[model samples]
Target: MFAPRVALASLSGESDAEWAKACARPAGAAFLGGVAVDGPTREAARELVDRDREEFLPEDPVAFVDDQLAALDDEFLRAGVNVRATGLEPLREAAAVCAAHDAILEVNAHCRQDEMCAVGAGESLLRDADRLCEQVAAAADEGAPVSVKVRAEVDGVHLPTLAKAVERAGADAVHVDAMDSRRVVRDVAEATDLFVVANNGVRGREDVFEYLAYGADAVSVGRPSRDPGRVRPVYAAVKEWFL
Candidate 1:
């Protein structure tokens, strides 16, 4: 049901439009700009920058998303914006821009930074299913495709249950960071019909096949995405698996 079998995952500050454009060839899709929207998120992002952790703290989150997605080549079947916001207004506004550009507005519920959690964003949303689903619903209400970026091994989190909740909240997909627990990708795929994008340590066809064999509809690469040469093998793996 999806066009892209492989995607490039978003990297803080680094996964901007230029980065996406540079790495556009190997992958079928890309997630760009984890933009920090709203006062609390932007402030927290600035704090992260102080610690040498780069973040996209744009003055206008909505426009930033627009310009970034607009810069991507149409060779990508899907383009997405990974956004961080503690409020519905900025989130909705950013989603509208995604809708306008036919890009997916991805809710960033996966970031586990202490600063992000302190502001009730990132993995904090994962812990609070109600809040996370609410953000999904809000973004979906904007008439744009919605995906929730999430991670594994969080305290008290069950991937199957969480995936079901996200599906019910009007999400089209779940971008899962299978951190150390790759089998959670299987659990989540079996639990919900949401398009599952398995991420983390996807170095070769072996890793891609592992996720695919576990029932993932797609796979993504994060840090490795910076090198198109590194991404080429993963792209070949996806094409082979899908065939």
Candidate 2:
């Protein structure tokens, strides 16, 4: 059997048609951006981050949040914010969108962008285990497999507890942001049984393979495919080498 390769599609600019096209490829799964929940226009939302070249979140981060929520309410109705939204409606919508597209849906609690965290999204969820579990369970009930993406935290010991909570909440997988630290990857892998995916700094097929060997059941690459020309070769390599 071929090892599965999941693609993280840039849902920011693409339409549902574009998303469906990407998902239709031989890739085993697709992950959409969670940041789209902020802005009305993808360009406007990204500007929030781009404007802050110094801190990666400019002097005013709400610019990003404004963009994110605008995008969510207008373009990506399925996008869900980690904290801004009070109820599960947005999450349910996100799950529905993934199901309609025949793709696996993921909750992004891993983004460490200062603006993102300050707003209580992304890594902020790590501090609220109970709420995270509730979100996970609600997402799972949407009838599609759900995965929660997270960053390894201080002491790293809390990962196992968090992973267990995720598993108990019915997440099909736990995507850990592996930031070029083999020790961190190893520690995380040893801690969880839920299908773990290692991401961050994964540049090529070899990196993907290394993650698998280290205990990841899957892996994700970001932005390498934004240029349509670069997408095929990477996809081909993944199919030829990993799958």
Candidate 3:
């Protein structure tokens, strides 16, 4: 599990290694740099990412992932370094890079972008539980710690069941974008043994404590952590809670 119990969720714009490093604090872990893979399944992801998101495409995704992990060499030595990535083709490859670099590799299943779903990446996996489980299993098999980031409410998808699936598939942790539902985090926590990292709408110390009270092992900060001043209070609260 991550130290201090505070995590920087894989916010689209903030996920680059450089940006994540800049945002890192002594008490929290920064989930750095998300990458898209090569293949037709990535076209829609590319289109969607091109609009407002900062997505990275390296000719070799494994190298790109390795480079990103390597970029955080100094930070890795001092704090936890985790990477969140999408795309079906490179879970194992990315996991390998993470293993090589001693970083955590998180599979992104929380993105609900229309374009991402159109390409069968992102939250589309929520609708395809079997495939997602397989991907996570493969990544975990690569000898790297794997965390699956999943959305709570997605119409027909059952959050607790998916959490169980991820745990059964060997994922070390489950990162939940709880959205407006703290109950989903509770349910997932109850259903699985995996460490639960609660994400979404975590604005202040209250939100952090609220999620932890609901059974989250850790809490992730998204939009609010974008401001340096905002990070201190949240970090202090998390540190205090852990203490």
Candidate 4:
């Protein structure tokens, strides 16, 4: 059986202390720096295209980049924070930040917001698999374990292709945004030798177990982290089932 591990969702805008509290969760194994390359909210994101029309290019193409990098740096400076991993764009600065922090770096290719695509980040990489592979390889060459996070397509044809490409790119793992049912996710996992982590819609112990059984090496929980009181029980349950 795969051991259950926790990943905290969306911490890019949060302060270091806030990130530390989430990382301190006993079951937590990784932290996704929530740098929404797109707008922070749905309504804001919808305005991205219209907003872009007013400028020659997207306004503040990387508006969120600096803040996200700062948050990652802050997390790194905290003592005994145990933040072994983080996710970011595979840019030179992002690679540098991950190296300085001694954290495994994951490329964010799962974001589906229009703003992200408009700015040529996130799922936009899916359209250019070779470049994405090159970027991941570059990060790996820099002594950081490069993982790529990708959303599973609705039709499922692209998932296998993306998984295989990441594996060939020398990535340490592939984080699958498994918003679909557990059964569908399991089918995708069966096709890859690379380490797989399931994210999206994982609410509690049973969901975690279902993911593990489906071949996820780890599972990430989102909303549960907002309430600190819920972390222990979830951690305890994971320990009970698969530790």
Candidate 5:
């Protein structure tokens, strides 16, 4: 789980420097991944990992995951790191790596990429509640403290029900990309005791306070997270609230 205040939402497979930079800032925790996972060595996370070996996505996802995790310095380790993975098989490997590193393993049910969806991964898992819970359970079974990241307002997806199911599966937390519906955060909070993290377009201190008021244990900053300045006020606000 994250510290008090805001968290950094997954920003794709960018760079360890970028990740370290974020964690070095004021955010409570940083979520890494949306990492692709099809088979053990078969790379299928086409979005971040194309045929070319770009900045972050390499040929082997398992190795790539290790490299990304290894990039986290002592400061990041203490701040908190949650890794998001797409497929179940890949999640298994990710869970093992997270367990070893004392990090949180998050199952990504928030991605909407067509290729990942075609494989029953990403946001596609939201529609398949059983599959999503199964993946979450599998990650937990690996002895990894698991969290499920989900997007609310998606067609046909019942946020509350899905949250309860994730709780039943033994996930340690649920990160909700609540989008425009901040109320979903309260609903999910009421549904389960699992730590609830609210994510989306959190602009300033007001939005952060609003989500917290809605029962989010913590709020996550997405696009604006690249700049630490944006979250400083939010983190300050949270700390002040606790005082």
Candidate 6:
């Protein structure tokens, strides 16, 4: 959904507006926050903290989305928020805020955290296709562009099949964390028309070539994203390929 085709994936507690703003280099879009919305998700987020996990749990979830996105008005090329919630209402609420800023509302179906799964907010959604599609539909209904962040090689989950389902449910793009599966990106790209953004283990030009050769529209760098110098080599690779 953005040009130049590289993105910085969301890091739970650290991917706020200022962090996103500072890290916006050689990447087209920066996904901010895996924000916990609603009662169950917020409680699950708190439990994660005890285990040294990071989460964004604002006192006012919707307003936090509003303010964070407002800070990025024209400073960034594109921005998105990856969110977790046990209910559909929270998805709609966040999507409305996303629409206001012309941003993407990303449904987080990719998180593998135990706490997030127990609350039916993350990888658990992958196993429950019906629930994930419902959440995608709910968010898309709010008029913001929609993206679904997914991972490869989850037990009982088929990435290509899941990609088609989410596209039918109104997702405009699918961000795939390919993990160790080498050809998963090609399969997902072949399965649907959704913009395919491949993630994980990307370091330099060669990494970008592998994903693009397999049909990825873009590549996303996680963990090493904040250090632009570390990822600076990929920018020229992406720019040349996408241009």
The TM-score leader among the candidates is 6
What global local distance difference test value does model 2 have?
Answer: 0.55
RMSD of each: 1.2, 7.2, 2.4, 6.6, 2.9, 1.0
The TM-score of candidate 2 is: 0.68
Question: What would the per-residue lDDT of candidate 4 be over residues 141-192, giving only the tens digit for each residue?
Answer: 7666667777776443377777788788877777777776556567657877
> lDDT by residue for model 3 over 16-132, one digit each (tens)?
677666656633566764456546435654675668666665567677667777777777322222333344446777787788877777877777777766667778888888878
User: Model 1 residue 95 lDDT?
Assistant: 95
> Which residue runs of candidate 4 sit more than 4 Å off their true CA positions?
1-4, 15-17, 36-90, 154-157
TM values, all candidates: 0.97, 0.68, 0.90, 0.72, 0.88, 0.97
> What is residue 125's positional error in candidate 3, in angstroms?
0.6
TM-score computed on alpha carbons, candidate 3: 0.90
- List, residue by residue over 75-179, the lDDT tens digit for candidate 1: 454688899989999999999989988888899998899998899999999889999999999999999999999999998998789999989999999999999
In order, what lDDT does every prediction score? 0.88, 0.55, 0.73, 0.56, 0.72, 0.89
Question: How much lDDT does candidate 1 score?
Answer: 0.88
- TM-score: the better of candidates 1 and 3: 1
Clashes of 4: 1
Worst 10 residues of 6 by lDDT: 19-28
**lDDT of model 2 at residue 214?**
80
Give the alpha carbon lDDT tens digit for every residue of 1-243 in model 6: 886688889998988888777767677888999998888889999999988887787799889999999999877458999998889998899999999999999999988889889989899999999999999999999999999999888989998999999999999999999999969999999999999999998888899999999999998888888787866778788877776
lDDT, candidate 2, 91-182, per-residue tens: 66655554444345566666555565565555767887777777787767877577788776544337767888888888877777765464
Residue 153 Cα positional deviation in candidate 6, in Å, after optimal superposition = 0.9
Q: What ranges in model 5 sit over 4 Å off? A: 15-17, 39-44, 47-56, 76-87
